[model samples]
Target: MEIKYIEKVKKAFEMVHTKKPLVHHITNYVTVNDCANITLAIGASPIMADDIREVEAITSISSALVLNIGTLNERTVQAMLAAGEKANKLEIPVVFDPVGAGASELRNRTTEQILEKVQLSVLRGNMSEIRFIAGLEASTKGVDASDADINSGLAAGCSISETIAKKYGCVAAITGETDIVSDGQHTLLLENGTKLLSGITGTGCMCTSLIGSFCGATEDFLVAAAGGILCMGIAGEAAAEKVGKEGSGSLHKAIIDSVSNMNAEIFTKRAKIHEA
Candidate 1:
């Protein structure tokens, strides 16, 4: 990867912390608090608005909109569409998280509807969720990604991401032990993060929030997605080092702290990225 792209990531990180952009989230209630906290930790304000009445109002002034389908419901589903449409109208960035997409018919249908309705700038999800959204066969257990591992050697992940991005005309970000980010024309593979992330409940949700934060501060959706993923991975590794043997609880808290204290220097030093 070129150093200039990495420089862009660094600039985006600092810009988010400096600007503290307002991020409107129509996210699931399950990991709502974690999403808010992570947004704040990365120096962005988060507003969780599910009510249809205020969604448009909130998105009107927000810099980015995050729509997560972790805990879907009828009311929130409409609210997400309302907010996402408003965000698009206002030319604000929209980051989508198709959580548990392939696990149930409801989730799958909801995801499809959101994709059709919203003009997303970034789509972040696990391998199975992305595969399902891309109209491919995938195995998912409940809301979590399947136990089947993603072999890093295969080009399937990169090709799939590129295809999805081209098909949808948005940045496709697939997260695993290795993260693949593609904007159809450009594809990147990021090697960062720790296994402790698997033990956390809201890490993926929080990552979506982080992506929103970065996208809110930068116009480059590809760079924004990569920065968010790298930030989470680096913070997870730092948190593990701080409290790896302690417990999941400690590690979770430490991850937030690491994000709070993270700087551009640390990000540039720890980021292991390459163009696919």
Candidate 2:
């Protein structure tokens, strides 16, 4: 990317600290705590509330809303719809993570329901999940991308990301060995993460949270999406360097620490983003 684009991302990253925006999430229980912590680490407040009675109230008070279908249930699905509608009426940015989208009928149905009801600012997922959302052949192995799908490479990812962005009318971010962020008109390829990032659960959820944090602080969803992905990618690299042989347990803590310590200078210098 050009220096100007990098500067735009840096400004979005710093605005998270300046605004300390409140991000409301109606996410699955599996990664809720880690999601909240990662949001805080990036200087945004997280309120994870899914009670149908209170979801609308919570979303109304927040700057951004994140909806994740990681662990889907009938009740939470209803809450997600209610909260999403409220967020839409208020013009709050919504980030949707279609976790395990192609794994089962329930997930696929829920993904479609959310897309029909909510106007997402950014739609982020793994290559398999995004491909599934784009109505393509996707092999999703219970919330994880199949090896064959992961090996599809950047060219395929860029096309799918753009297709989804145009179809959904939002920024589409497909995260993998190479993360692709596109808003139809412009696409960015980011290569800054570690393979070790896949060793742990909730990293993808955390990445979505980071994106929501940046989205909460800025109206430019494209830059906000890129900034958030870049933050998680850089943090993973930093954590991998520190953990060394200690394994995923240590890397988990170090990842949060790196996110908490991330600054504009570090983000700008270390980001491996390019325009496509």
Candidate 3:
């Protein structure tokens, strides 16, 4: 599984370098700039639009679509459904990020509605968010969860994520210090990210965008997810090493720089993993 993940990562990188697919995102305002920049750094084009007028049009031409509910609103939710339906009609892959799923009843209902509208290739979010989407009661504090046990959160999340993936018929990804990806029977644990990433405001949103970019270009959803996580995680580690506790601002800059310098060879060499 280690070799398989490595190969998949390499394959995804190559596809991004070659296809350079356009990823359409109906994402949040908090991470719009970062998400677009990161997508470009990874050799994928980014289009951020939520306006009902252009959302479906943009998604129709895009290679992959991403839906993020960080700042949910009536208009954006409608636009997300419209874009997702358009993308689905074209058979373009779609990725969903339920940023603050357990925060409110409205959020949970909205996520479920979106899932019913489109077939998600990958669902990316933190433990609480993923757990909420999986029909589990999770403690959520607005946009974040403090109940996360850093030591074993990944294991517990992975166990639950597998069940969620099977139930939803899509790849479930719960990201943390050690990210977990599962497709029911198969599971992969990624130990490639850095602690400093938690300091960043839009890291999770950016990861969702990154995964969308990969999904746009790669036919293999799992490979695309691994590519996004491994690449982003490695970049986070590089950024942290360069910043060294100064602050999240510096770390964010380093993350962009690291991503700009990242290539297929770097991921093939540095990614650590436990997989099926």
Single out the weakest 10-residue window by summed lDDT for candidate 1.
Answer: 145-154
| Residue 136 accuracy (lDDT) in model 3 | 69
Off by over 4 Å in 2: none
lDDT by residue (1-276, candidate 3, tens digit) is 688778777888888879999999888898899999999988899988899999988988899999999988899999999998898899999999998888887788889899887888899888878777766667776777546533445567778889888988888888887788988878998888877788789888888878988898888888788778888899998888888588988889889889889987787678997784
Better of 1 and 3 by TM-score: 1
Q: What RMSD value applies to candidate 1? A: 1.2
Which stretches in model 3 have alpha-carbon errors above 4 Å? 148-154
Clashing pairs in 2: none
TM, every model: 0.97, 0.99, 0.96
lDDT value, residue 136 of candidate 1: 79
Cα RMSD for candidate 2? 0.8
Which whole-number lDDT from 0 to 100 does residue 204 have in model 3? Answer: 86
Question: lDDT tens string, model 1, 1-276?
Answer: 657678889999999988899999988888999999999999999988889999999999999999999998888889999898899899999999999998988898889888999999999999889888878778887777776635423488888899999988899999998899999999988889999899999999999999999999999999999999998999999999989999999999999999999898997788888887
